[model samples]
Target: MSIEEPMRKTEQEIMPARASQITKPLGYDIYPYYSLGDNKIFNGYSSLCDFIIEQKTVVIDGYVGVYWNKLITALKEDLIDRGYALNLIESKNYLKSQAQLNEMIAPFLGTEGSVWGTKTTLTLADYFNMPALTEIEKSTSADINIITGCGASLSDWKAALIYVDLPKNEIQHRMSAGSICNLGLDLQKEQTEMYKCFYFVDWVVLNNHKKALINDIDIFVDAQWEDSINWAYGKDIRKGLEKMSSSVFRARPWFAPGAWGGQWMKEHMPQLDRNEVNYAWSFELIAPENGIVFESSSFLLEVSFDALMFAQNKNVLGVHAAKFGDEFPIRFDFLDTFDGGNLSIQCHPSLKYIQREFGENITQDETYYILDCKDDAKVYLGFQDNINPTEFRDTLEKSNLYNEEIDIEKYVQVHQAKKHDLFLIPNGTVHSAGAENLVLEISATPYIFTFKMYDWVRLDLNGKPRPINIDHAFKNLDFNRKGATVKQELIIKPSILFEDNDFICYHLPTHKEHFYDVHRLEFEAEVEVETNNVCHVLMLVEGAAITVESADGAIMTFPFAETFVIPAAAGSYKMINKGSERAKVIKAFLK
Candidate 1:
């Protein structure tokens, strides 16, 4: 009789050190093997796919290895009997370190991306409003501080990094293999007058204000292929940014003619008036046919953030592009709208909700930063102070939220936004910049794959039904928060402000993998900082700052303070604001 005793469930055990999973590439002579039950061995064949198939059922517990030899031998014997001589193949030690596993897989991320530009001089205090950035150490929802590559310039680089299959680009592959592969970069070295000799990379990394310089094509900036690859790695992505200083660079407002407004916004959101907009610019390396756009419940405005739309391509992930950590592509915009479309609202789905419904393909989380605003520029941030989902939905369907009479801020928290105002909105947090307003939105990579919940009785110009995923909305809406603060409100201390300027250094407050938790250094003063990790980004907001050297011959300066990055290997650097106004900068570091 079967045992009638209580069930005995066992947990998996930890593994002891092993020689497998070494630098040896797939199909290498040194194959992986596992021991199973007696006479039930299996083979970890050379081919990665083959090894996976052969070891499919093998238990990998260090204490309970599944035999792999016998199984492979049996399969081989059968193949031989059938007159087939198996061929053995293996890859070289192409992998430099365990970190390469992620690098080898970057081709799986997407090609298109979106990001915002500066109005005047963006300050460190304003970065909190930036869209989300992916962090391998921690998600935006999670308390982590690490960041990877920013998408503000992702469009400018993605086409070269993705879509075109390199192997098929026979000539390009040869050039890359000879010129890029095996060709290591000397971080301490210099090449041409304007370029670094070995730093062949993909993107010219920068912060919001510095990147805005791209709007003026007349400026001749040094770029190379190695830096393009630099942009591919999380740690190295910040390499070239060390020299940026925001103090003296002239920042053209987004509203300036030829800055990508007027004719642009006129066609998309006819309601948008050129005068109301403070500034606009295209940060995309190359513009897409449709330009950058974002959606809300009732309002669908051609967003201010720039995006380089990729032609249809394969799935690629930049999980390891940032060698130091993983970061998400987030964008932002200061909407200077004249009317509050009764339907425009802020809402997002949760990770759990997206996974359960749309799987991994749909990832989203967003936040907003209120910039300059008029007294009447109210917004709908989060749900009503006290809300009953059922009751709210019942009224929402009736368009009560859409009635122009409904002052959205009264339902949530209404606050006027002056320069340097900051707000943090996590995913599932129901918030919106409401009608008749201007606000800076900082958020995670803008992937509209989320399941929408509500669209305030709004329609496209064609007057057709706009899609809504209410069930998904309810799944992620964060009902606990309202207004400017995130989940647990952080008390603001004036000490957080940079001296003599509105530059703010509110802690990003992240806790996860050790790489992204290092606190941020926000400032515009003549300050010096030592590097601890391999990467860091110093996004410049306002003014010009130069990196200068000390009498000890150990100083480095970023004279022009636009958004810039400093690599860990850069040693020590100092910043000096050349502008009459205070400089704004963020010192993001790896923990």
Candidate 2:
């Protein structure tokens, strides 16, 4: 369903009012990096070219959206200027043609109107011409032979392997700018289509390839910036990752604006750009889209989150590693609707449905921990006691087709939201975060399986109608969760699990469908926490700042609204309050 563009004022004209009192200055470090040893990371094209020239044959493989043309051009000029003959083999030439790739991936792309796609079973080698790659791998007749592209490693060449990585957020930015294409494709598609291809196909194949070559990679490069490059030895990166897996760390969080954007993040996070429409999402620890940054002597390098998983999945996930393998099972993010519109009424796929349809191992079982909310804030969840499935579907479809507004509360139950309220949203439970609240969405790692039933009859940021998925929602909705059942099953009642004079822990239990549980530690001074062989995903919910000190005495300070992780291998850690008031931290771990 679609609608005509609605006339609306610019974001600047509709800015929300500022807070009356001054809050703590934003302490979120956008470029949080783990420290690599000095001299481990090298910068500049000159140094990179110098290192490549010394090797007889070098293959430079990287993620999609990396600027291979510029990288190769710079290396070619520098090597030729240094009086070395170069045999530059472009890896794209050996890949499958555009028409062939499109035909191969069509089954997974689904319909044009659909946002969901089946995870691809194809590998990087499936997109390549093996004969051509073998021929190139056999011939090395120049002073320095450089093979570079997305699947350069598939050549099976016995040479120095360098992997260039681009962050997921940067790849989206480049997609929006029309500067990059999907794997094995020559032409750029529209942003949404390109993102769909990237998510369902390109990323899946590339991540598999990268994991296979993680240990064999001799060097790793961060190609996020245009003018400069950051490179480091692969061994050093592995060492840093190993150290981090046994300690506490934070992924570099990224922010974005959306149709239902809010002013809460803009007002509290001073580092964010106030000129934007509004900040609606802060990707705190969504592992698939997040990157771990490593710093060395003032230089910074970022490798995708998968690198950490591939290198040390056992240490990071502990006993759960056996089941999840390289996948991180938990996610924490901020859904800001403060002084903004309500979120689209949506529900996620059930576990069996997600597995059969999307090939995902987990469903998006989520919980909204209300970190802050205005007095009138509310959360739409479940259905009324007298809800009719057919009638609800008819009303939603009519709303979508005719651009009419439906009385949502007539069907769905709306509960008042307050600070520290935890609402459990298992798969198939219809829910939406109402306006004037900051929701810390802690959930399973499958983040993109939402099926929106209604969108409040509003135009998106691009002035286009947002996708409505009534059919998909109906297929997965749990009508049993209605009225009294909703309150008994979804609304979390906090109970004191542990206590003392100065410290206490409150257990906010999740639903039966959820594999994880939640605990809020409120401490006036400090509290010692044991991991118990399960990784802990935590956020500083109610304190200005707190210091997380590992057993080995490595300390990292996280401020309010910051999401950090304590690996299962960490064993024990201490959270020392650095603020004037009691520190409250939300902790999520395996059940």
Candidate 3:
């Protein structure tokens, strides 16, 4: 079968079903582990046999985290059956030696120790010998030249390029399970390089496949080694996205360890492998590190969250789509410090500063909604009335350089955090969550712009001093949010906005700078929620469980600590409490 011929046939086989057939709530068993059945084209080895017979060369550029030998062997065996000779090219053969990589990254390393700056930029060409690969492609005599590496750049030799996409969670899972080797690279540097690979996958590979070579690619598979595999042609795969956008969306949550990690998530999220040291964060809705799940009859498909934003930006963001375009404008993540230490004393940049410095559309304006906290837990916010700016700067510098434990209380104010306290942290306000707190950080989507000023003079989990950005902090910090002003404005007091027979809505006031609003929905039976052309982000903050039903009759349940999104296109939905006790949900949406 020719590639162009199979394209039309596959489209007919996977055409979008009617709205009713596709909008049903997926069974609990249909995600993260399930596999869609094999076909001749999608997620199947037979899909590429024709390519091996037709093309003189093929390249399989994939992440180093994958089992490349197994995948390549499968392709080679299939090619042999089709009476074609195959020559294998290993990317590792061209990698710079350990000493060379270390020297190349030396300038980016911090002077204090082995820590690396966030701006350490490395490209795929920097790590792999692409010139050598091009030469091999030109000279190879085999019927098919299978070039396998992290295909971070587009090349003509990559005729019929197929990206074997894997979620970041699964990549870490393979790493932690000892299924893949780390190649003796610094963990931070490895992560940095992997992120660059991801950028290439999304930008260079996916964009070209979905746009330029929409009908030319062989297969794009969502792979989890042997457990699951899903494949689709570029065009049919895009049609699948349209069906998914209007439905209830959930991203695969990824857990990672941190210096100030806690056991809260390890105890709560049983789906995670708890053998690890600690789980500090659940990247619940951070699109960069998250993935959206799509289910078919036999298998579940997973793509990066940004794929949905790219395909259906207006459907997901609704009226706010113009402002954010393909970027999802809100973030929801857990900051677990329970039985751990405080977060770094930090503040996010203002909009102007973030745009000029970090090239971000919006700043990380944030709010800390206390989900769970120990009795003695408190939040350090703003500055004390008598804090001297010069003294504070000098103290932080000394702490960073000389490891001095300057009295934090002398400069920063601490406020008691309760079960439902909402602390508004607009950009430029210094803040940190104290020990023994489970903080649900609801804020604008721009997360990585945090400028840390202090870190309690302790080393990071990697046994190195974390980078401190005192100059950035001082430039963005708003000292006027101090003394009584912090208490009056930053510490939000919730007020009842509506009440009925079975439900009560309490408005949690946001800062003037906040483009979104947070509301606590306390209910015994049910509550009618309108999308109002703005998407709503929901968290089961104080509940055993609840079910969200769309107007079209599609429904999905949410348990405690679970994060779910309702696209503005879904219009209206109902939140029905299923537990015996009353349920409380923290809902954030555009104001």
Candidate 4:
């Protein structure tokens, strides 16, 4: 059944030198950045109170899982000190019944893995009843009328808007800490609601200026960065905020635990709360849930990653802004299964299937770049040459019905994994990384359209069986990706592109269906690269460190396995190898 049992015929000759041979540079933990505290914020709550009290009707909207009571308390305390009569209206009480909320989310809920699918397919505004706005208005008739909720709006009257925003991770943390409570809301559903809220907020800030203008708004309170909240006001505040994020930006990473999670992150990411069972996913650059951290001298301010894109999409994304508008089209994440089990055997939906069924614009075309792996590590990909469509479907169905383990070796081809091996996973290709591997997943923006055919016969962390998607997976699975064809196409053999004393660039070929390409630069001293109207995402895959110096003289140092982006406007930048030994950097950009 296996065309090439070892996958690579001459693997021993092509394997890179052991990564342990490389020496890590001193003080290379990505610049040793510090967390900025409360005093660094430009404007405080008092300033927001002063600015908002000057207006008539104010609408304070926020993310779904925000602590509205705490925010209202802060605002009320500030306004009370100034001798102002304020009537605060809460939005949760205006929400429809639990039955209505359940009905609205039913379309997005189904069994996928051990966890249930909890994405909110509809808009946030659709979750509210029109009559609730009347109730909110009826209760607000004091010296200052302020309405607050996730669904708060300025549609009724010409009111000053105040958006109370929080980072996605912070909200997730609060949910985990039981500070923000929704009875039946799981983490997946909570995240989906917040992401949809982000879409709504981004659209409003970018397109509907007169209705809920960002610049004309009374205030914007961001509580994601520091222990204390940040408030920015004034007519030119948008310009100032844009300037704050104009130079360098990094999104706050969010981590989650899963059944097949590993111990690598729990051991390395000391900043994370290590008490969790195991850390599975580190959402580094998924902008909807990610937040941008702005570091100042005394303090650091943070806001949702989309906020900057909403305000300065043209400046941040450069040329691609016109094509994608508010959408950021690249994603980088970690899939660490070191000392753990294999991932579920899965295939992503095709472009037509994803758009028609899931309402996504792009398919999940992915690649796995092995950052680190053990000697026995392997990856399951493609299919056996002897696979039969009818038998495969019948076996999968019988396994689901009888709760039996799958004979994976007979159905899927396995490949030996090594450090820096690039595996192309186009849509409809069956793939999964085996145990003892630290995989850096660089792929298209879409992340959640995976149709898993089989999971090992083990219950989820919750002691429930994972759902098998045989029918849906069969519809999108490419049966032609088997035997020798898979070896020739799915696996990449890097070809020498450019070589010199300073650097040697190798082209990691991607599938023809992939719009992006990857290149690895092995350098001794330094090298300069240009961005020809497309953004480049950089990752320090090997060695200790590398420093990327922009044309404007901004130097950003990256440690091992750190990811960063260079905008198209960056023009030309020099990457200096900071380690004593040779360094390897992977560059992914549009073709």
TM-score against truth, every candidate: 0.41, 0.95, 0.79, 0.82
Give the winner by lDDT: 2
lDDT of 4 by residue, 164-202 (tens): 766656655554434553422322334334334233332
For residues 243-356, what per-residue lDDT tens digits would candidate 2 score against the true structure?
A: 999999999888888889899988887756688888888899999999998878667788999999999999999999999999999999999998898999999999999999
Task: Give the local distance difference test score of model 2.
Answer: 0.87
Clashing residue pairs, candidate 3? 35-299, 36-298, 36-299, 43-231
Ordered list by lDDT, greatest first: 2, 3, 4, 1
For model 1, the stretches where C-alpha displacement exceeds 4 angstroms are 1-343, 359-363, 400-411, 435-440, 449-466, 482-525, 534-538, 544-573, 587-591
Q: Which model, 2 or 3, shows the larger TM-score?
A: 2
- lDDT-superior candidate, 1 or 4: 4
Question: Lowest-lDDT window of 10 residues in candidate 3?
Answer: 3-12
**How accurate locally is residue 18 in candidate 3, as Cα lDDT from 0 to 100?**
17
The 10-residue segment of model 2 with minimum total lDDT is: 13-22
lDDT of 4: 0.67
Separately for all candidates shown, the number of backbone clashes (residues 3 or more apart, or on different chains) is 100, 0, 4, 1
